[model samples]
Target: MAEDRKAIVPVWTLATGDVRAPALAGGEPMTAERLAELRGVLAVMADVPIATLEAHPLPDKLDRSRGIPLDAASPLAQHLSQFITQSTRSSLTAARATAMGENLYRMVVPAKVAAQFDKGFICSMAAKGTVGGIRGPLVTSTGRIAAGATFVPVGKAAAAGAAGGAGATAGVAAAGSAALTVAAPLVLMAVAVGVSAHADNKRQQAIEHITELLEQLHEQKLEEEHSALDGCRDAIDKATAILLDQGKLGVSLGLDSAVHAINTALGAADRRLARWQTALDKLPDDKPVEIGTLTKSFPGVDEHGGTFRAHLELAALAIALKRRVVVLQAVDHAQSDPGNPFENFTRALRRDQQRLDELESGIAGVLVRLSALELARQDGLMPVFTAGEVDRLMRAAHRIRRLGDGVTVNGRTTDVAIEIARNKDGSVVVFPALPMGA
Candidate 1:
């Protein structure tokens, strides 16, 4: 029996931030306490930007000219604004699923795995010609022997023998015995042929039965394929609707040039940070940027070097970018506007800064997600085989893995082979080969 084929499954997760900027004053002097606080915030926002968003849910909503609300702590507000931003993540995933159907799921399952499992079935069936019963015909002979028969016509055997005398009688007995011996073998031969023919017919019937079952299974697979295709179409429609909504949000929020602005801002910040460090470098070799060592809102001020001011500014920007990323991701919320026109190039300027923040924040989160995805991808397709049957699977997986060595994905070469492993509970596992140079 051929083993069921395996499929390549890619792991997928939502990308949280692609771009971001923390809330820091453009030309503010940094203090040891402020620098430490900024670093702490950036670190916290990396995994869950809930704190950052809660602190400054919407930067545009704030009075940018008035500067960051450094004093606004949890005591002032009952809840955090980050939660509001995070809520959008769920909305977007749902919307994506609704619009894309299998497309969205395909990202996680991968085209390979989907194809394999789509046609693969796990079941037990008898081999061909193994069903039904076989039997041979029974032979029997009715018995009675005639005695003292004569060859000549004499009305009856006993009378003929009597008239012919002893010689005639003996000849008549021999002739009767020869006749019975010849007829017995012929009867046995005919019975043997009949039994052989019956058994052949039964064997053929069993083969046909098995063939029919196989055909039915094939037809069932075809029906499923049709159903899955329909689902894909439905998903496309939903995705289109959501895309339109996102476009509208883009127009309303002025997100058209957000990406460009983000890049520009990051570039400027990078340059400013560089220059600030250069200035501090001229002061003395012994002096370094002493922002702080504390993990909380403040750091130790043991070494008082004026470089702390510059350090604070740099740290603050990192935090601010981190916050922006979270806000940007929030715009992707599917519920906000399914098919939002945000993708509309003409309306990029229409996207709000809040949306920009979400997108930027999403970048970082996406990086982490991507790393996890890659690891999951390495896990290859799942197994659906039992331990005892592992060695008996079809060679499809091995062939595919070998093909992968010479094949390229997205233009990158890999030497990964697919190895199928089975467990005792009738489960199958697929292991990807190590990359070349690994």
Candidate 2:
């Protein structure tokens, strides 16, 4: 996996009353004492090798004669044009004209340098601005900016075979086959008991009961299809052979067209089987019925009977019924609802919805904070830096070997040993060396 690279731009603020003079208690020039304090702060900044990018007012189309400075005397002023050009190249051209009245300036520093400046310089100056002490001429603040990417890995061609229309059709066909395989024998057993009748309510009840049982069996088989789809197909072929053998046996016993009855039952089972298979297919994999409950639901048979031929016929039918029922019961237990599937699904959906809502709210808050920061910059209460300028400075510092391996920022030590590499398949991976101590 390729680790996402986030562009981190360090931002600082300086309060200047030039743009919004009325916002100040009184519109005043730099006092002698205040100017001395500001000079001291600037002297400390000059010692630091960090490049500063100052935002300047540009002439609009109405005032085209007022051109920007071609060269700067100060080191901070020297980087202004370069920063603007870099920002424009990096698709931040709109930022140049977005804010008109700000006298804000930005500095691009390596994380290590920023950390040192904040701790060794800014804190000392801020501490001097106490109630009983002399107030510092400059008002300063600092922040950082970051972004991330998410990647989803794609599987191989073999995995792709389990998706798309062809896979779906094959799944339906297999389910139908499993349903009919288990259903055919059970239906025959019901018909052998002469439960298929017209007008007799008891016979109708028996037929309905058999149909329900077959449906339940079909569902179980379909669930097993996830793991034993091929096995179910094999079982279907064997069951078909057994049905044929039973029909021949029925003929020898003088039963009238038992083969025809078996075929008729298979046809009827196919019709209802498809519907049950479809229903089972829609069910999620996680919801499975209890095996114990399914086992208890299956009908058991006694071997006691009349004449040898009659007893054999009855026993054969009973055996077929029990076999199909056991298979069906297993299928049901493996696939059917262990608990309320719908309720579980609904609860999961609600939780996901709530999570999405929370994420949306969090993102909105970040955006609002960013907007407020921008407004502060425009009002000359904050300083701004382009991400490109920050990246360029970091790269240059890295080349010169001026930056350190670690630095303390806001009372926390942040290591710079994180390495990012890209794979041949285009995925990015990140490997961060552990810091000293556990």
Query: Which tens-of-lDDT digit does each residue in 32-113 have in candidate 2?
Result: 2332233234324333221112221221211111111111321112222222333343233224322232232212222332
Mark the regions of model 1 whose C-alpha exceeds 4 Å error after superposition. Answer: 1-248, 280-283, 286-322, 330-438
Given candidate 1, what's the lDDT at residue 314? 28
| C-alpha lDDT of all candidate models, in order | 0.23, 0.23
Provide TM-scores for the models: 0.17, 0.16
The CA lDDT at 304 in model 1 is 22
Weakest lDDT window of 10 consecutive positions for candidate 1: 137-146
Best candidate (score: TM-score) = 1
Error of 1 at 71 (Å): 27
Candidate 2 TM-score over all chains jointly: 0.16
State the TM-score for model 1: 0.17
